[model samples]
Target: MVNLEGKGGMKREGQRSLLEKAIEIILFVGALSSIIIVFLIIAYMSLEAYPALNLDFLLGWFWDPKKEMFGIFQIIVSTLYVGVGAILITTAIGVPTAIFLAEFCPRNVRNVIKPSIELLVGIPTIVLGFFGLMVVIPFIRDNFGGWGTSVLAGWMILAIMSLPHVISISEDALRAVPNSYKEAALALGATRWQTVKKVLLPYAKTGILASVLLALGRVMGETMAVTMVIGNPRVAWIPTSILDRAKVLTSTILLDWSYVEIPSMHYHSLFGIGLVLFFIVALIDVTATYMVKRGVIK
Candidate 1:
């Protein structure tokens, strides 16, 4: 006996199975393509930069391309210095604001403030750079005394630029914590503050840390804003003080790339600088992912 209904059902199931396999193949291809693209970029940059990369390239302190002085030690140091300073400032301010928004703010007020913070993220970086150039630089020079464009200026601009990322990510982490944990703490006679301190923060620390890492990457890679306000010292030197003029790696590349002959060592060296930055940001991302995965148990 031919069962027409069973045949029809089998046909539908076969069709659905084929569709599922197609979707899986598409996703697999997408993932493979991304990995392949990344490798291609790294390979291209490495080949281009190989001629200029060496111990001297990594450790030399001066960077005058005309004379082929391509030591980027000071530039690397300044990049780290400004990035660390910005991360510190952003983490300090952003984490607390995130906590308040997640745990304490009234709904209406949270609505207003969170959107405003997100909006700040949308403002063009060039506009921020111009603002720092026109206003922040002069204010710093008048009040704090060095060249208006200083490591301090870079820190301030980067910190502002990084704040929205830290706050939004940190707040989501906090909010994602199981509400039952909070309720449980309160039922056990812990105060609200204690619950937040002892329970919420520990649970959310991984997310908060991830946010800071993301901000660090953003600050390190910022070009125009840091370039505008960082003094871009004529002679690259490790900044000894916050008020000292300094030039970071991104600024160096941005300032010099256009002027360098495409086939020259100077041009290759700039790509090397980019390669170094790529490794740094990749390390941060990997570390963040590892820590967050490990932290899931905690």
Candidate 2:
């Protein structure tokens, strides 16, 4: 009886071991698949885009199909400007809104507002684009000028789209902070506002930074919203001001996909822009990761 019982225990242990090994294999395959897929995309883009990767080709700032010429330096710059501008606007608005929600709003108000704001994310980006087109664009044109389809319009649209992500992540970060820290600051007679400024902001900054990076990622790769309102101009520049008409790398492909043909120099150029946009995103992610690893946010 003792021997049989010991054998049963060993059998159960062996089964558990097999299950663990199976899970490990599954996880490894999942991880490897992601890496494989990413590499495949990069490899294909690189092969297709290599032909159009010349400095001269990229300087044209416009594609002339008859001339078979293309230059996207300004388009790249516009993408960067809109991306950065949107980040700035969203951070200003979203972070403060997050602070209000996490720190100031009554529990009841927070409960209602929080979910409502997040529902904005579920709202299709096309809806947001239309909001910019019919409403926001007209408002901007009325107030600021320049045909309304300016970088400012794109910035505003992107900011609206990004708010839910930024506010939610930032509020969660602020809330993740233990209540003890705030209590301690108040106990020491610091103003409620000061406690948040001194203690909460610093401690919660890592999460806030995460929010900014995520929003930047959204702004960087945005297409439809940018396409609808960015006023992708023929004679593009580095976007001297917010009111200037602009073009971004993403809009180039999506906006022109119909005319670009399947497999041509134009298509290759679009692929090159796509590859460039991919790297820009990867770089932001890598930089943020490096900062976190280096304790830059502490």
Candidate 3:
């Protein structure tokens, strides 16, 4: 009977080992598939975009397919303007909300509020764009002035879109700091706010920056909402201020792609624009990773 029981235990261990190995193989394959897909996309875009992928297309100020002009410098600048502004607003509001939720909120309130904030992510960008057009645009026009569909409107909408990501990730980061650090700070005669300011925040800075990076990516890549509110300038227009109407690269691609024939210069140039966006996002990710590694961000 002892021999029988030992044999059964050995069989169970063998089964568990096989199951674990299978799971590991599945996860590794999944990760590898993602890497493969990204590379494939890059290769495809590069192939299609090579004809129009020169410095003249990137740095020229005009972008009229009719005139055979496909410069994206101004569009790129406007894209940066809206993206940076949105991130600034998102970080300002989201980091504070995260701090409150992580360190100061009552448990009951936090439970109710945290999920509600995250729920905002499910709200469709089209709906947000419509809301901006109807409400935010009118408000901006009536009070702040401008065409209403301006960079400021784009900034405001994207910030709202990005807020959920920042708050959720940043709150998690702050909460992830060891509780022992909080305890130590308190024991050292630090007030709750001081402990949060000097200990919790500093310790979780890396996580907060990660959240910001994610939010920046979201802001830069967003399409419908920004397209609707950013005035979608069809010419070579650069924003002089937050109130100026301007074009962004995504909107230009989105608005123009439907009209262009496949294999046309316009179509190839659109792919070139996409490639530039890809490179921009990649550069941002690489820079942030390097900064974190070098202790520049932390």
Minimal lDDT window, size 10, model 2: 289-298
Taking the tens digit of each residue's C-alpha lDDT, what string does model 1 give over 170-281? 9999999999999999999998889999999999989899889978987898888999999886678888988899988898889897688989989999999999999988
What lDDT score goes with residue 237 in model 2?
Answer: 68
Please list the Cα RMSD from the true structure of every candidate, rounded to 1 decimal place: 3.2, 3.2, 4.2
Off by over 4 Å in 3: 1-31, 286-298
Candidate 2, TM-score vs. the true structure?
A: 0.86
Runs in model 2 lying further than 4 Å from the true structure: 1-27, 57-66, 290-298
Angstrom error of the Cα, residue 291, model 2: value is: 3.8
The digit string of per-residue lDDT tens for model 2 on 1-298 reads 1234687878887887899999999999998998899999999999999887888666666555556767877787788889988999999999999999998899999989999987776668898899899998898899988789999999899998999998998898888788999999999999978988999998888888977997798788888888899888755568788888887888878876778777888888878888888998988888767765664435
Ranking by lDDT: 1, 3, 2
Model 1 spans > 4 angstroms off: 1-28
Give candidate 1's error at residue 269 in angstroms. 0.7
Q: What is the lDDT of candidate 2?
A: 0.84
TM-score of every model versus the real structure: 0.89, 0.86, 0.86
Q: Sort by TM-score, best first.
A: 1, 2, 3
Identify the candidate with maximal TM-score: 1
For candidate 3, write residues 143-240 as lDDT tens digits. Answer: 99988999999989999998998999889889988899999999999999999999999888887897798678777888999989989866868889
Kindly report the root-mean-square deviation of model 1 from the true structure over all alpha carbons: 3.2
